[model samples]
Target chain A: MAEIMSLSEAVTANVNDGDTVALEGFTHLIPFAAGHEIIRQGRKDLTLVRMTPDVVYDQLIGAGCARKLVFSWGGNPGVGSLHRFRDAVEHDWPSALEIEEHSHAGMAARYVAGASGLPFGVLRGYVGTDLPKHTDTIAAITCPFTGEQLTAVPALRPDVTVIHAQQADRHGNVGLWGIRGVQKEAVMSAQRSIVTVEEIVDELNPRVTVMLPSWVVTAVAEVPSGAHPSYAHGYYERDNAFYQAWEDISRERDSFDAWIDRHIRNTRDFSEHLALVREEGVVMA
Target chain B: MTATLDPPSTKATTDEIMTVVAARELKDGVVCFVGIGLPSTAANLARHMHAPNAVLIYESGTIGAKPTRPPLSIGDGELADTADCVVSVPEIFSYWLQAGRVDVGFLGAAQLDRYGNINTTVVGDYDHPKVRLPGAGGAPEIAASAKQTFLLLRQTPRAFVEQLDFRTSVGNAEGGSSRSSLGMTGAGPAVVITDIGVLRPDPQTGEFVLTALHPGRTVDEAVAATGWPLRVSDDLTVTGPPTAEEISALRALTGA
Candidate 1:
């Protein structure tokens, strides 16, 4: 069982530079409040692992919190283009770590392979394609038996994994409920785990804890509205205006730091990020 | 009652094979965690067919996704446009899957073993693994949480094998209820769909025993294509041939 900690404390204590931390959330839901806490703490040299993020990741990287990024796709392109990500991509900062672009399955499978202590997670999607170019961050090789060339995705063992849930207790035994076991891979790969949740519970019995309880989840914190506009999937509703605003800001590289300064760096609470959303109003869940 | 060996009624060109396999997994009212390629195709086909209500969720957070066709990968715009909602990857896992809401998770593997141990890695050892493979997306959770997992592969010696270089996702390790004791929180697989028909784990040994063969297929063909020696049930059943309605509808759907 982990000790009860505050949001601010967990963020500052666990996250470190050059740590390959798996940030929770996908494009918008469950906007990894823990990751936000990390950004606020000004943690740097972080490399994120994921297929995509709405703007949270872009904000983190733009704020100079992230030094390396890996995944199949990083930006929203023209529509909700990840502007800060693009700037970082096109020399926003000098020499960021490898920006890999492998298939989504391939990326997650590697992480799973690592967590399971397996050799490789076979993938058929990228077979005989240029997708191999992007996956070279791990590299590729030929099969000794058939001489068939295959992408070699090395094991992914994250130093820390920060996740969010619908509910959890001090020991970090979490229950995400339904349609949200997305962080299972990160949980599998991490050396240490921290679960941030909407509310704290008294007892997370084995009968109710969604994923297994035995994993060494180091700590827990109460985040009530952790996934405000970004929702916790079934628990809350989508914060479209926030996503829309994030998409718009991610369009131009001109105001990268200014955007973060006005939205994040200048704020102490959540409303400030929404104030820039242009909707004039965003109700926190 | 239908005698086998219906000749090669179009073995399915590679792309077509991809589409056929994809369409085979379509269903209605099922919740799916979608990825690109075979999984995407199958999920989309499910939506297009009777399973219009079938919801597709991507690791990127797009949910109730109804992509018109397969996205190049996870980032394709099709996923966004067709989705009923979108959230973070973590939410997709924590809330939807780990929470136990999703039903079927469509997966494509590089190689598979008798126990459903997948090798997405190489052909050799780990340290200097012979061929490094792509990593897992959300498949592990899909395998663990979905009511049951649906795997779609064209099938060949290289794919259907004796041993997977690596075990990317856990299927029926050591078979039976042993996984439960090992703390596997997710539901074990109920079935495995393949080009040859379908395979189910034996009741006692957990070794794969062939349950059915595609229309006209013989045991010899399936075993010949398998990389390792295969198994069969004493009372093997013949798999139904793709109905004309199925073939035509499938072809038109896939556009191959």
Candidate 2:
């Protein structure tokens, strides 16, 4: 019972202002197109969630779509620091951004607990660590079986979970291969979800059984080359140059604003945005 | 192909020396949970050298990643394509890591203490940090759960601090029964491979004791770099320079 729709329509209907949204993908299959749509629609006050908030999250944060970021790490991978994220914390240029941080293990456990319909997640974490001092979400709980103590984090039940996959059937059965992080748990843990796929086919022959049946998915949008800077498994290669170029673009506030305004805000859709990137001779390979 | 050229007498950088020291610690068939950057280089070098069967797990859920070239990040797509198997992130942490299946956890940190507790979270104040570092991703769990750990870091007074600004990963946790009291299963940091040399925790005190120094680096140099009053082993060894085979393999893998 999933409806295939346009990325814009999906974002408008599903993602809303002041909602907690998780765009989950490790590095591959990042829903950059859907994130751009959220920026284009001018959604604000959203608490964006991801294990690692790479370029897309930087764009969303830079565009002033996010009021808070609930994540583990926020950086431009391999290149350097996320300047916009740093600016938001230090200067609060667009707005004051609240941050709730956790380790990758803690975040994954929280999502698993949420998907499992549990009240809280338990793990051996935050011991001899200062994360508990900064964030209220992480707490220490005593083990009932033994007299041992462990870490407890609240379940992450987001308002909407947005993810990108390689392909999905017309019936909305999404299949993602390669490095799939916590997309399944993210989708299942959310109240509603939007999946942007590279293609919609009759059936899937995924290398592995990393598929989401139609029952759990809410909407499927066909956005080819959706994970532009990030790569889709089989569609294309990662644009490492853009990741390096982002360091320069995001360093200055004016350059960051100008880049986002031209590439994301000015373009109509992902295809148009991609065309602009290519037409400008930005080397993807 | 017939004529063999003599090994170059060119000197290696401190970084290369550190890399060689870290890579030599790995044994054949060890399961290593590798962090990005320096640890990745060491783990891959281990594979190309003696530990060919060592399983390299990235936090991105790629188990046994066999990248033909070096991966830029743990989440790089190239890691996935090259990996033996890819599972969900939850499974990677829960089943492989937290289950104590990982033999060696290789990590890097901004700051470290005598007890081996690492601080990758912040530099100064927690609330208003002088430098807000990339928060802990999986290092906490990896540090606590892996059977043992190997740390690669540059030796400096600021980095080898007396007290970490933040404890992103617990090593001995003030040493003694503290680690066991916290329900940590790992044996804590086994060895810290720095540019100056190798430091291993004393069995009784758990304070890192300098056991070896790299060529041209003296015990005084190591002690000067350490923030705490560093102790030296009575029978310390000046570690042998990188072997010809090790250097060749490392150069081939890293292409530097």
Judging by TM-score against the true structure, name the best candidate: 2
Candidate topping DockQ: 2
Of candidate 2 chain B, the 10-residue stretch with the lowest lDDT total is: B1-10
Q: Weakest 10 consecutive residues, lDDT, candidate 2 chain A?
A: A202-211
TM value for model 1: 0.54
| Lowest summed lDDT window (length 10), candidate 1 chain A | A122-131
* DockQ of model 2, rounded to 2 decimals: 0.73
Query: lDDT (0-100) at residue A263 of candidate 2?
Result: 89
CAPRI-style class, candidate 2: medium
lDDT, candidate 1, B1-256, per-residue tens = 2223334744444444445545656677888876566667666765665577888877776788666656544534456556787554445665777667878777777788787756543456533434444444455556666667767676689889886665656777667666454444555565566777677778666667778777666899888878877888888886545544555555555565
DockQ of candidate 1 relative to the true structure: 0.05
> Could you give candidate 1's per-residue lDDT for residues A1-285 as a string of tens digits?
655688777767778877888765544334446766777788888888766543667777777777777665454322334656655655545235445555455566567776788876543234323235335644556778986544566666778877777777655667764334346677777887777777777775443425636356777777766765555634565554555566655555556666666656676644445545435444333
lDDT of each: 0.62, 0.89
Cα error, candidate 1, residue B28 (Å):
9.5
